[model samples]
Target chain A: MIEEETNSRREFLEKSIVGGLTALSAASLFSSCHGDDVKETGEKVKLLSPDGTIVEVDSAYINTNIPELHLSEHNIREGVPGKKFVMVIDLSRCKNARKCKEGCSKMHFLPKERSYVKVEKMQDSEMAAPYWMPMTCFHCDNPPCTKVCPVDATYKLSDGIVSIDNNRCIGCRFCMVACPYSARIFNWGEELYGLNDAEAKAIPDHDACSSHKLGTVEKCDFCPQMGEKNELPDCVKACPNGVFYFGNEYDDAVTNGDETLQLSELLKTKAAFRYLEELGTKPRVYYLPPVNRLFPFKDSEESKNS
Target chain B: MESDFKKEHEKLLDLTKELMPQKFGRTGVIWVISLVVIIAIGLVAYIHQLSKGLIITDMRDYSSWGIYISNFVFFVAISLVGSLISAILKLTHAGWRTPLTRIAEVIAVSAIAFAGLTIIVDMGRPDRMINLFIHGRIQSPIIWDVLVVTTYLVISTLLLFIPLVPDIALCRETGVNPSFWNKKIFKFLSLNWKGKKSQFFLVHKSIRILAVLIIPVALGIHTVTSWLFATTFRSGWDSTNFGAYFVSGAFMLGAGAVIAAMFLIRRQYKLENHITDAHFDKMGKLLVLLSLVYLYFNINEYLVPAYKMKHGEAEHLNDLFTGHFSLMFWSVQFFGMILPIFVLISKKGRKPLPAFLISIMVIIGAWFKRFLIVTPTLLHPFVPIQNVPDAWKSYNPTWEEWSIAFATLAGACLLMTIFIRVFPIIPIWETAEERGIIVDTHEEK
Candidate 1:
């Protein structure tokens, strides 16, 4: 029964994103044809128009094409349904390279100092060896953050993604306190990222994570915009060591960019566990134990400063 | 018999003359102006915050809450005195509470009004406040707080105003040098209170119903406020005992506030006859009892958790007990709780002047105590702090935050000051009746 509901929801999301993109491109195409006189350099470029037809246009007439899909606000909130997204971090494989953090920051248009992913140096006890743990929002099924939100600004979606509506958020910071993982960050000031107000507003809402409204709470959203295109999250794509895996739980398949694996078999064989599992948050992200050393655990310059 | 009746009537008139509202003197004027100045400055700072964002405050992502929240808790705590002095004492049949009820209710109304405002001041988008009502979730503790705070404010205002009807009538009939607007307001608000037997009976019955109603609402307001913290999974805040702990501590703070107000009002208005040494003695005893109860809860909240020394809890407790927050922790405990207990327990300490001084200490201590509850727990989230600026690890409130916090406090005081300037701070008819002077509003002047 639940699967049927999710399938229909997924179809609706796809239709809306495609519909929005078509309208957007049609408007832009009309403006380019009428609003400005085309100076054709006669260098032909084959482009797939919004209707899926190949058309030749002057290279000079081609502005960067609109993103392939533009999920409306309603679609973003409903999420790409029928798939329970999950992530696995193989602790033994991390070498503190921090490419995942860099990639995530770049994709979100976050400032150099702000990042959704943090590569933490963690030591369990006196004798246990320390390891690098890159942390993001756990997207807990029993999300304490969403439960405490007075305004329903942050909510858990059908696709196992915890999302935020900055437009609706009152910026109370209660959710920041409720999340045991310290995963949330606040837009304490105006975050234009050097863009003027008009420029910032011109960026599509789904893609404008960096220009978040002042005083709202924001965190790792798992790159739902990318998910619409069947692409992995930036962190998953950027890891050099294959330490991160992205997958659909219902399909029982998880994949690094290089290798795909069965989820249950991988967990059973590697002794996978969730961070702070005893809290009963039921996190979707799982971690393999740091049993085997990949490289000697050396403190990164960022870790030392912190 | 006729001579005796005339003599009693003369005495009642004298009592009314003594207790009627007075014009502000030079000191009063200065106090009001200074509060206005602070409020103006705070308004400017708040506008700056609104435009620039909460970045003006030193709060980073980790210590997301700061002095604004602590100030909110303090206002909520102090406001609990309304139910303590008026409803609780009245229900308990404490006649000595008569002089203090007006003061307590005024404090409750103003503090609670500002408490609501302070929460807005803390919000990142004060413009989005309407969303709370529109998209409110009943499951959220913040919604619970809003509901209870508003209910308490209404009940408290009614509690303050209902009992003042006969007094307002008395002011209308026989006020000395009342301003033209004051006379008009008194006449409008008096609701034709004639001091008839039926009217007295109605007033008495209404007071009784409201007195009962306010107790549960008062408890709910503070309990819901505490739940905002207790519902969180943080080590320091995740205690089952938070409701009782918060209630007891609030009562202590409220008692301390009442004592301080009693001393200052008595000195300023020369109301030593009404707010006497004996009243101070009783209130001092009440303060000690409340402080002792709060101290017991304090032990439960801290000691048991410390005993377990659970990994997450241990880090948090260590920070409070002997680590970074230790100095503030110990000072608040000693000066705010322990020292007040030790001092107020003695007979000399319960005297008017000494009790007043200790109450001041308690009020100051209680403010910092709230700060301790909010900030320290946030600093020690379950995950270790890493890969952020060092400033994110510790919270230090900036000038803008301080100014805004002080403005709220000043705003509350200004409310009470304006209330006192306009209305009698003590109920005239009630005081006259207690002294066996008959009050007949229908009698011709």
Candidate 2:
């Protein structure tokens, strides 16, 4: 389900970017490069060209020419349809093999290539043994960020995902401070990413992309865009051992990219937990206990790509 | 020049005009220049902050607010001076506040203006400042701050302006020799006042009404500002004592600023006769009283926490008492609060020069005190600041933040400087009447 959602987001963004460019500019960029019969076969279109004049171009450019825009403009207030998402990371699965971080960073196109997920080494005191705890946005039920926004720019969707309306976000960052989990990161400069200037220029609108701007607030989008691809989330797919499960709460099923299991059975069997449960954040993500270790605790080469 | 054989009174008028805020001479020119330079630097920094994002500041998720907030509180606190001198003194029937009124009024206007501006600078999206109104939520304390501070500024400026009409008329009418622009401005602003009986009655009634109204608004401004923090769930910030604590601290700061202004006008403009050693002595006593009230609140704010030491409050106090913030915390307590009280408690120390120096110390120290109050508690919130780098856990303001904060202060001074150049810093007619010889009730009667 997550992979299916991620794939759809890519397709929707690409369609918009190509459709968003007026016929005039497409003619200039592609007139000499592509064929004329392609231009004649589609709907009559009016577009503003690169030089400020109007021109006509083939509608085929919509599909054959442009790559998909990753940011899809579905009324964000109305969440992704058909699935209510959740994640279960069984801490007992392994040590600090940070493959999850590497995959997340690459997929998100983050700088220093870091994403919302972080691997924190934890110990209660000098005598306690240190453990590696991976962190992600809890995507809370009672989100503090939504409560304080002077403009209702950040909101919680009906599907139980907390989302930000990037275009409307005034960059106040009050939400970041209010969040106890430290789940947000700011884009502090223009993006350095996989796309070329044309692709970057055609990147989805504030409503389109999960990452907004240098002046604005950003964090994880729960790989909702990637979830549409009918594949596991980057982190889940990247973990060599089946430690992460991506699923839908309503569907009652979860998959770790290798095998599928019922969400309730997994939690009941593993005695799953959530971080900082005292705060009443009601996180969508849950974690299973590390009592039965899957791998010996060690800081391995897992974090290399994250 | 030859009209009076009274050397002291004649010398006093010269001193008043000279010290009454003359046109910017060389030192004044340099002073204005520096303030402008600082404001320019701060403006550039703010623009950078807007373009690149708030990440330019050291403020992480943990310590979200920094010096900008503290400076804003300092400005709001200082603005309370208008209410203290203009209303409280009038209510108490103090006969000797005549010459000090203009300085206090100007300080009030300037501080409030900066107070309003500084809050915007702290906002992450100053460009979208209008959103405060468009999407204002009553649940938030920031809206209350916006409403109250603006009301206070308008009332204070009016209180400063309405009383100055007769004085501006006096400067215009008695202009045996006045500068061209001064003569022109005085003529325009005076509204051809004949000092009629009806006019005096109406003016007096209006001034009386404003005096009564401003007292509550003054209290409201600082209290509402305090509520901005107190309304939050943060440990050190959540306190019922916050309102009164803020008001008392404001009174001390405003009094300190007023006395310091009085001393500068007395020495530089040589208004020794008009603003006497006696006035300083009285002001010193007043400062001592205000300091005591503030001290009482300080104990309430700190001692209760130290005693019960609520889990979160305990961590916060450790920072102020002997941890990261110990140096600033102790210095602020001593110079901002304790030492001023000790100095003014003695008769000899209440003399003009010493009192003035102590008041200046109190003002400077109080500014830093505000800085400490805002930044430290936020850094020490209940949660251990984790996951981020070490710098995120600790806060040390970058030079950009410092420069921006200082620039706001300088801008306030520069605004006052321009105002002084345009208007008399003392109410000439009011002071003359207060001294003795009453003007005839009719035009040239």
Candidate 3:
């Protein structure tokens, strides 16, 4: 069922990108050179354009690389339909290895100095036992950040993901102030790592929502692009100890790439609780307490060195 | 009897000459030039900020707001003086404020204008500023702040202009025009105040109505500003007392600003006869009462949080009381609130020079007090500050931020200087009426 949904969504994403590519081709054809009629050659390179057309291209012209689909600016707000995405982090499995953070940063093309997901050493008080808490956007149902945004730039979608439209964002930072979790990070300068021309051009329909810009806020987006490919989020895939589970509540299943579990059964068994529950934020992410932790809490050598 | 009339006419002419807007002397030229240079530099820095983004400032994920916000708060605080002196005083029948009303109103107008500009300066994408109006959500406190601030600015401008019409006419009609530009402005602004009995009645009635209308709007402006922070759930911001606390503190700062402006105008124009020792004494008493009330709110804001010390509140309170912010916290409380109250409470301290000196201290203290209110609270968010660059952990504003903030300050001063250059700082007709000296305008006509 999950595979079928993923394939159909992938087809939908391809159609949108193909529409964008056709517009691109139309512009290029008007300005420069491109053939109007389809032609076949002995090379017969098969090309599956996002538009869902299986066309024959010369071997020299065939570009097999399937770049991430950049949806239309409007569709970025719609999210994946018929989905209520949720994350469950089993605290007992985390030892602050930071593989999850590394994978998340690499996948999101974030600057080295920042991460979408952070592994924090937390102690409720001086007397409480210390534990590693990997934190990111709660994607809260009652997102304080979205509520205070005067421009409606950040919004909670029906599918339980709160996202920002950078083009619409005025960079007032009021959303940052309203958020209790401190999940949002501002792009203070021009994007440090510029995309290569080919890569940039590949995303013909780049939604301003997914694009980061100077003076805008950015945060974890649950790797919605990866989800379209029937893959778990980067953090879920990269966790060496299977600490993170990403799934849809509608599907009633979550997978850590290695193991899949029923969302209700796992929560019932683990007695999962959301962070700062009393704040009434109604977070989409849940946490299992650090009961029977895998490794005794110790300051990691990397954190100490830094 | 003919010789006596000639002497009275000469005396009135001399007084008018002394008070008329004079061309900038060498010192005034230098002051104007310096202000212009500073404003130019600030504009350059702001352009740099626009191109480079807010990353040029030291703000990060942890301390999201820095000096730009604090500078905005200071501007909002100082602007309140217009309402306090003109509206509150006029409503209460304290006619002694007549000389200082224009000065207070000018400060209010200029400060509120810059308050609007400074908030834009703080925005990361000022290009998208139109979104605030177009996509403005009434659910947000920011929308409320925008609405109230714009309302306050409009009302303050009208308040300043309505009272200035008769004075502008006086300047124009009295044959004391220093320049052609002065003549044109006074002629345009005067609205033909013919000194008819009916005109005075109309002017008096309009001023009365506006004075009554401004008080609630003035309160609304600062209350909405406080709501910007108070609506958030951050440990330092989640206070029910914030609205009243902000209002009381703004009143104190506004009074201090008016007192300082009064002293400078008195000395610069040598209008000691018009300003008077009695005016200084009355303002001193008012300052003391305002400072005491603000001090009570200060106690209420800090003491209750300190007592409860809920884990989040405890860390934040400790940071303010005895931790990193202690030095600033103590000094602002002392110099801004406590010292001013102590000095103004005593009879000797109510003298012009001492009162002026104390008022200056209070105003300076109040600026830093705003900084303390904004920056320190932001540093102590619910989540502990960690990860990212070490620079993000503690905020210290960059030179670009300081330049833009200082430029706004210079801009406000320049506005005041230009205002006084064109129009008389003190009301001419109102003062003459109070002293039972009817100016014989028929001779000039």
lDDT of 1 by residue, B147-258 (tens): 9999999999999998899888777767586778887888899998877767877888888999999999989988889999999899989988998899899999999999
- For candidate 3, the TM-score of chain A alone relative to the native chain A: 0.72
For candidate 2, give the lDDT.
0.74
Mind giving the per-residue lDDT tens digits that candidate 1 earns over A226-272? Answer: 66566799999999999999988888988988999999999999999
Interface RMSD of each: 0.9, 4.2, 1.6
Q: Report how closely model 1 matches the true complex, as a DockQ value.
A: 0.65
Evaluated with TM-score, which candidate comes out highest?
Answer: 1
Winner on TM-score (1 vs 2): 1
What TM-scores do the predictions have?
0.89, 0.78, 0.87
Question: Sort by lDDT, best first: what order?
Answer: 1, 3, 2
- For model 3, how big is the iRMS in angstroms? 1.6
- Candidate 2: misplaced stretches above 4 Å? A1-73, A81-89, A125-128, A189-203, A207-210, A224-290, A295-306, B1-30, B40-56, B60-62, B307-316, B378-393, B436-440, B443-445
Q: Report candidate 3's fraction of native contacts.
A: 0.78
By TM-score, the candidates rank as 1, 3, 2
State the C-alpha lDDT per candidate.
0.86, 0.74, 0.81
Candidate 3 residue-wise lDDT, A38-132, digit = tens: 34244745545545566443443333354444434226778765578899998888998888888886676665557789887778779888788
